[model samples]
Target chain A: MSQIPFTDIVANLPASVPFVGPEQIERERGFTFRAKLGANESPFGPSPKARDAIQTAIEDSWEYPDATSVTLRQAIARHWDINTDNVLVGAGIDELLGNVVRMTVPPGGAVVTSNGAYPTFNYHVHGFGGTLHLVDYRDDHEDLDALAAKAQAVDARLVYLSNPDNPMGTRHTADAVADFRRRLPTDTLLVLDEAYSEFAPEGTNPPVDPSDTNLIRLRTFSKIYGLAALRVGYAIAHADAVTGLNKIRNHFGVNRVAQHAARAALEDQAYIDALKNEIERGKRAYAEIARRHGFTALPSFTNFVTIEVGGVARGDRLLKALQDRRVFIRKPGVPPLDRCIRVTVGPEDQRTIFEQAFAEAVQEVG
Target chain B: MSQIPFTDIVANLPASVPFVGPEQIERERGFTFRAKLGANESPFGPSPKARDAIQTAIEDSWEYPDATSVTLRQAIARHWDINTDNVLVGAGIDELLGNVVRMTVPPGGAVVTSNGAYPTFNYHVHGFGGTLHLVDYRDDHEDLDALAAKAQAVDARLVYLSNPDNPMGTRHTADAVADFRRRLPTDTLLVLDEAYSEFAPEGTNPPVDPSDTNLIRLRTFSKIYGLAALRVGYAIAHADAVTGLNKIRNHFGVNRVAQHAARAALEDQAYIDALKNEIERGKRAYAEIARRHGFTALPSFTNFVTIEVGGVARGDRLLKALQDRRVFIRKPGVPPLDRCIRVTVGPEDQRTIFEQAFAEAVQEVG
Candidate 1:
């Protein structure tokens, strides 16, 4: 018999794009990747204190985590010098993005974003049946003026811009971000994803103000704080915007061990600082590999370096050959942006493996 | 300026009920509870092997978790002897319930549940704008026949049932559950919450079949497996139902530590069998306490006991007094059933503490 009817919007929508995990790829390829530098994860892991916290919190796993995430929220509030009301903790930036999209963009409403900004954000927008209006990146950085113009043209409810963006590691200054925020329609919410903000140059993140209503800045421990697998992220927004998120988010979504570990990670600023230095070195290593191979490596302010591969066809071939050689790397999906492969910064040994694999792939592809 | 424009549905939805965390209660009351027999958590904690896995996985937290949760799904699939396609892992039963509700019920569609069934499911139903039709619990067990009647009456898109139910801790026979499923309208999907099923009698769970399209069974590691704070739960459903869930759920929602710990927990069946024995002892402890206090403790098939306080007002008074005495416990929210306070079973000392506080509360309230 046919299955019961799904909601009209969901039923009409295509099945979610299936995700092939690295493990699945390993299973299919008949060998494990020698270096895992695909996803833009923090190569340097969490602080020892944070790891200790996870172990210590293991015994407390029987208890339900505080639904309000009181301790973590208070910690974040103190970090930003804002009230707890100004912070909303979620499972991750991905979930927060979905919540923000659901709260702002109504079904069939318009949203504007750089075409290749964050596919997951686009997924959420589409899941909610929101129409996305695209603005192409300017020189691999989010085109703030073009995004604002598109939002205004569509009278969009929301606009997305990733500073020190993904797939292409680039950034706009804090002043530029603030200027774009001011230019956007006041009624439109700007979702400024700063998942890599911790790695950006000085003054890249706008000064957070509790009363700021025009934008929300999303941050995660996934990159700098080095807790990607734990899935914790926060959004700094107006109290009302935070309240709007509360109306839709799962109350106990963030796990207890994650909350404790993240709080500890926050206290270990030195750990983050040292990791950034290491990440900066790793990024340089990736650039060096590209230089040696006669490919242009884009300037990066984030954890990964994007190397130009001449064209989409070359990029695809190189990516496949790298996978064949058991090196994991990713590239941008849509074009004008698809002519490069993005490699996450890794430790020295992993970088060496990636470099060797890259040389081999290039030899075969060429 | 006023807040950015929220979607009409979210704007119109009730300000999410303010959650008063148990920690906040302790803070306000100026003391911590001596006994933490609330929230239906397994005080037994996770297995030693699972905890070890949690510690071991802490180093891997720098990487993003496998988005599809492949290995954990494989473990669960083997445990049930079902196809991996039939299993979908989520952060918790709470999150899974929300996803299932979102996928099935449309705006203004009807969903049937017991009046005092799982509130989180009701929250999700209302959040998605589904009109809830309540059928009171039959002797504090989910009234399956009444639920079926309501679903038929309203042409409901979904019906929620918790065998070995929460709060009241009563359950229906497997034969009854299977019969109800057979009689249910094919169009109305039964959301079978079996979170406490592991603590149930050997034959209590309905035999699982991968082809079952009319219902989906949800299980959690929170109860007997003792991993509530890690937020791991899984649903065994028809492959089509599983595919529908994939269309909207957060891909990397389950965290890395949880994935490893749950896999380990699943392997340690000896730990589960032992916890069930401990839970059985704790349940008997609650019954003995009820006997001494002249209260009727509901016969429980799960880990907790519901002690009747004679009336809703009395139950409210006893609950508050117990809280004042630094004893954390919970009572049902709605009336008729609200005459009882549900106490999650704890260890030997905790059960004694609960009995003493419960006696004190009764004396003061009387």
Candidate 2:
């Protein structure tokens, strides 16, 4: 049989996947992890109201979701005190990022991001044949000045920044982010990913200004709201940018149950507060566990902690040992960040499992 | 503030969208439609087991779905008697189409499809800046022979065909589709969308053969399984084609609840059988309604019926009258086909509403 003729770019590209889930790991090893913390999902789960709403809407799965996502968008807009036109709901932030990349970056166009930042955004940029410009992190956080300078230098079409960033679990204050946004060349679109914003400290998120057209802020229900399984996220930007998303976005991408559940989740402020408290507890426990193991845990505003293990090899060994003992954890790919293992904050039971597994893994690695 | 610089190609492209939903129309008109049949959604709803599964999985929504989608893929593979490697699950057939298009047709690459078949597929083609070669429907059905010829003539990277087709509600037999597949150029990837396959006649679907590397068959829960609102679909093909999808597909595209619900839906054969029966009953009722109005109901192997309205102008007038009477239906966009109105099958109450609106619409148009 003759091979199908793919485009030159596609044929030249390797089949590189962004990330493998814990399920695939279990399938290959023929064993399931006792605790899953590798993917940074909230362990507290969704609110009772959100859960109930999903249950009630389950029977209506046969009908296509409202294409406009009216109710969810309305709730989101109300929460932020913005117009509904400023909100664009999607399957998730990942899908929304892909759409944003497609809209701004064509083949051979330059897009900028930190060297070890979210790989999913890089994946989308590469999928569209865009030229990716990488800037190194400064002090375990995204170097905003360097990113902006790089974007201006290359006349990059888009720049991606995740506050309370992943992998290292570090963050920039709201003023720092706002200054970065203001300094960026107007021709460069800034994708300010605030996926972890809900868990950040006071003054972490900049005051909402719908008038700002240069940057698009992305938020998700997957974090503090605990609706990661529902796959709903929204981008808040100027109306034009939001409407531009309509040109390429899957209109009915957000599922009906997700819409209903997200609305319910938005209303349950008490649930979010409780989740924040639980996350704090997990953070403290994780810090103590790290200290006991003679490792340094990075202060995190997000729902995960990154523990520096002294060396890249040690981090890798620790991760493998933890996985062998049925506890899943992940490490960053680039150094000096590679010396750390990232662990998600979860309930006390999960933290207990992690504590026991971490001790064993550290001894085995040593 | 200066506008961000988008790619030249993106700037040149028109901001065209795919189909608008019934909800948008109702919102614009300031009233709900008495009978909602525009988008071809199943009104019978999903199976009780599927609904229950979604309800039960709701609490887990706070966790991100398994990116590998193991359970759903296993179930699909088992159902089709194929290896899990040959199955790729997605948010919907619409998303799968976008991924396939991205993989095969790079910017300015040629893609062939029927002019008015599935607008979403065309939207994806345009989104990727592919050159579209459209073949008009012959005898109210997709002309496979013409499509094959066009693909060969243009050396098209991909060709799209919807079996038990949309818009016209016409279908080609399994033998004919298999023959067409055999005749197509080896390099041309054929996307055989069997979205409505469960509602098709016994011989309408080609035999499942994972060995067939050039043809990708898409099936969805949106039709017979009644999970459109959940947005779950799968593509079946050779391992090579399936693996190619992993390179660009949003790994966590399908929601966790959706996966569970779809798996349960797959297990409930009785529910699907009942839905098929209801669809048949709806088809008969619609046919009778068409006859009473001196229109010819087109033969359909799917859940909807298309009726010839004598002329495009009259069809437009009738459609407006129906809208004015709070009935929602759709018509095709091209010539000859534009003279017909399409209606989806629903429960009896909705059918009665459609019947009353149809009569009023016809009288007003006359």
Candidate 3:
């Protein structure tokens, strides 16, 4: 063909989104989101120290960020008590996930994930031409044993499991995850995404075992650290996987502001603690709101609540109604999951606003 | 078999850098560069408006940036008189180049570029397992005729041409480039990297044709926009290429702060004009410094000047000498061009510091 040709794999892939940002919805609706409670971002904002670091970084905004990300990685490695050789930082979990798919999954290779799991991981797997083997969530938590079994059956190259999971905002115990890790096929690498680990109850993160070739755990400053807009996330992996990432990843992908902000954010444990409490309060408020609306709010460990509005039609209408009321939120994509709406923890004021909006939205939808 | 294996291409690739960032050199030397005249970053810094935008945006660092990047793309499209569909923003030209390489070139397919041109593009090609065909620069400008020939010879998927070239700091006229664009094989994609275009002489950028399927021109906030640290760059291409990018890109890759900074940077034409003049003055000062040191300063259209230090040994000695004196500058890696050293335009005070350091270093090395 005379025109440029994407690789056949790329050619066959649909133009898809990992997630639809609330900004796009606001623009489409021709109004700003009055209560932004989607995307699981921390409403408490980044640590004051990180914010100050960002402001200070503005003057030096012309210099390229450190490509090797030596200092920041050192900070991250220290925070986890791991060596720098085991750490690799990237733009975010999203970018790192892409690298994971590219590195481990060959064309036509199989991968396993929860059916309603992090769509971004599945998106990346598809982008890399990997055929996904989906195992549905069990009790709103990723079916770990099912994932391992499917990975073994398909000889899947990689299997993804997010702890304190998104959408459902449920969690698995660290001991249970560790046991799950031990049982997964030795050859199939496990991607343990702990993006919400800081907010989960203590011990949600299994002890780091750099020698565990079966695992690579992903972490982020985007959740309790409140630096999602800064886009800094990293993975703790076997040195081989880390080295593989070095070979194919964007070396200078991390921005300068993010490097400094992330380091500062990591240093502030007090901030993470306070935000955890606030998120806990918000989740409780969401559950209360769901009760008032005659719905069930799933128990959540992360900073979001998933409320079932009874069925697909009710959930869809309520989502639309919330949008009409200028309250931006998102719903799970797959059915059963789609029968619920996911709302991120926002400020208490935002909670009240959403509560009132939910009441009116339900009445209007009904 | 027990561990996760990188795909064969990634496994075979070396852990390498497209460019060794100056920060790495400083760490090795155990001292910071006093002049900081490498990396071609703007010493003038981002515009006050952009800086203010960055400061303002820092508070919202918890919320994710727009994945679609609608507003910023709209503003960029309006700036270039193109549709939003015709533009795609990425982390930087470095990233967009990677995307273009992935989209156009299949494994083992051929791509073409100047031998000593942007090494980053070559790194991406190699990362994607695309065999690179190199044509040496003719007269310090990318040999457009030669590049076109090479593209056809290899049935190259993409050919790169950098106008207002880096390292050598030379440029081709817009009309000449337009003609070159017409001559290139229709089947080959021309990656016109105009990173230094704004600082080039008037008529440096010919009008782009969105219908021109053979071309995808890259523009960056890293250069004239003075927002390199923020990592914003956009591509002007046919809608097809842009659509392909969305499928594979890290959707929220562009940090929220960068979007605001780049938009503000683009809107402030007055700031750009002033910086251009400042850069021009700095380039002249470099020429005067080179004259004093018995070197020839090449005519430059970009923010950096390439000074011929007589021969390879002298260039090598001078580069090491300058580094030892806490002045960081770079030299072209290939021979002939290796006889020259590249120095970026810095602040007036920085120029004096570099000038004094250059004189002492030259004497010491001699």
Candidate 4:
């Protein structure tokens, strides 16, 4: 018998995952890594209060989560000094991106972003049949002007920008980003992803203004709160935008324990402050390590740093050597950025292990 | 400035939740529920081993979940005697339904289901711009023949059937369901939601047959495994169908702790068997209560039963009266089913409280 036919767009989509997880790599290699620094997950775990909340919540696992996620949203709204209607919690920023793409970009609609921005965003665009327009990075930073210009040219429905961007830990100033948003067409929705906002300078992010219907800010507990495994992220946007997202999102997608833990984490500001300090210390140590090895460490405002290797091919060789020595790290696949390897800041012991592995890999590859 | 425009599909869709959670109702009413039995979530709770696994996994909450959900899917595949590729894990059956609708239903595509089968599935169908054709229930059971006929007439891209149907808690035999599948058009994918299968009698659900390209069977850890709050569900289908789902699913939507807990829950079959016996006892007690109240109880094959009141208006009054007394429960909205109140079987203490509340509610409403 003939097989069922998939919708035209899905039938044509390639069966691909945006990123290969470290666990996938371990399974393939038949061994565990000595230092796991690939995905930029926080080496320092979640706040103790958050951990306690999750342990307590395990007994209630038989109950369905609140479909509206009212408590968590209210907490997030308080954090931003906005109403609960302005916040929408999802399983993660990834799920919110998928919903945003579906709600704003119709099939075959245009979307614009930096060429090597978040691949998962691109995946959602493709999943929804939105055409993506890529603008190349200029001087190691996302070309905001270029992105705005292309969105205008294509009449794009959505444009994405990440502050303290991934793959390369470069950030544009708050004023620069606000100016970029102002330059975009009113019809074009600006997805301002601030997953690393907590790590960046306090003034690096524009103040949360839910009055701007054309912009939505994405934040996550996955980074500073150190709850990536919990899969909790949220979007702060205009009330109307949140309503649009609600119409299409899976109502129960956020886990119950996640909602409780995220709220607990949010309440522990002291823990987050301490975590930032530790992250700064790790960044400084990484920069010193790079200086000792005669390599350039990119100025980073996030928890990870990009160390410039010689070239793309050399970077690939170094990455392979590091993998062989049981150190897991990732690199950008796009051209100029491919010259560097991205390493997440781990705890002291893991950082020391990464340093040793990095030195050996450089020697062997050279 | 003008607000950004939502996509046509989302703009036209209602910002409505499929089910109003008991928590939402409690918040609105300003009181706690005496008996929390509204959503059919397991009142028995999850296996102790599953709770232990979640507690152990809490320390690793900083890492992202395995994007592939490899271990959980492998365990599910083993349970069903299928290859790993035949299993697709999702945050919950609700999320899997969203992906299925997106993959099979083009804009304005036809879909068919009972009028009140599962509001969440209907929500997804509407979210994707699929036109749903409703088939009314026959004798409180989903009219399988009518559903198949409607699919044939509408050339539906998808058709949904929930064994041990929701709202009414009635079920059809395994052979009858298989025959209905055989009758559907090959292009019309059959979405067999077996969420309550564990509570159902043996042979009530058709065996897993991943070789059938047109059928996808959805099961949840939410129901019998009692992990609804953790939000893990899986689909057993042909490898090609799994590929189609993978091309569009949120890869990291499933929580890390949820995955581990679900696997442990799956391994504890002895606990499940004991839970089943306890549920059966609860069902018997519920039936006796209904009889004493001079109401008819529908023959139930799941954890919940539908108690028939005199009429729709009476059912509404009873529901309201129960709410006023702080006993949480739900009833169907459509005409025939609306004449009945659906109550979940809870633990002995909760059940005793519910019985007293029901007696009071009946007296007050009458």
Interface RMSD of each: 1.7, 1.6, 1.4, 0.9
List lDDT for all candidates, in order.
0.87, 0.88, 0.88, 0.92
Return the DockQ of model 4. Answer: 0.86
Q: Name the lDDT value of residue B20 in candidate 1.
A: 58
* Candidate 1 segments whose C-alpha is farther than 4 A from its true place: none
Q: Per-residue CA lDDT of candidate 3, range B203-250, in tens? A: 888887887777899999998888888899999999988888888888
List, residue by residue over A1-366, the lDDT tens digit for candidate 4. Answer: 757769999989999989998899899999999988988889789999999999899888999999899999989888888999999999999999999999999888999998888999999999999999999998889998899899889988999999989879999999999999988887889999999999999779998899999999999999889899999999999999999998999999999999999999999999999988898999999999888888899999889999997799989999899999899999998988899999999889999999999889878987
Task: Decide which is better by DockQ, 1 or 4.
Answer: 4
Deviation from native of the Cα of residue B215 in model 3, angstroms: 0.6
For candidate 3, write residues A307-326 as lDDT tens digits.
98899888989989998999
TM-score, second chain, candidate 2: 0.98
Ranking by DockQ: 4, 3, 2, 1
Per residue, candidate 2 scores C-alpha lDDT tens digits across B1-366 of 579566665666677778778888888999988888887878888888987888678667777888878899999999999999999999989999988998888778999999888999998888778999999999999998999899889988899999999999999999999999888888888999999889897899999998887889999988778899999899998888887888778888899988999999999998888778888999999999999989999999889999998999999999999999988889999887898999999999999999998998899899
| Clash count, one per candidate | 1, 2, 0, 0
What's model 2's lDDT at A342?
A: 96
- All models, RMSD in angstroms: 1.5, 1.8, 1.3, 0.9
**Candidate 1 lDDT, tens digit per residue, A1-366?**
747568877887788653466777898878988888888887778898888889789879888888888899999998889999999999999899988987887789999988877888988888888998998988888888888888888988998889888879988999999899888886888899999888888899889986878689999988888899999999999988998889888988999999999999998898888888899888888888899889999999889999998999999999999999898888998888999999988889889999898999999999
DockQ of 1: 0.71
- Residue B50 of model 4 has an lDDT of 96
Best by TM-score: 4
TM-score of chain B of 4: 0.99
lDDT, candidate 4, B1-366, per-residue tens: 667769989989987878889989899999999889888989889999999999999989999999999999889888888899999999999999999999999989999999878999999999999999999999999999899999999988899999979989999999999999989988889999999888899889988889999999999998888999999999999999999999999998898999999999999999999999999999999999999999999999999989998899999999899999999999998978899999999999999989999999888888
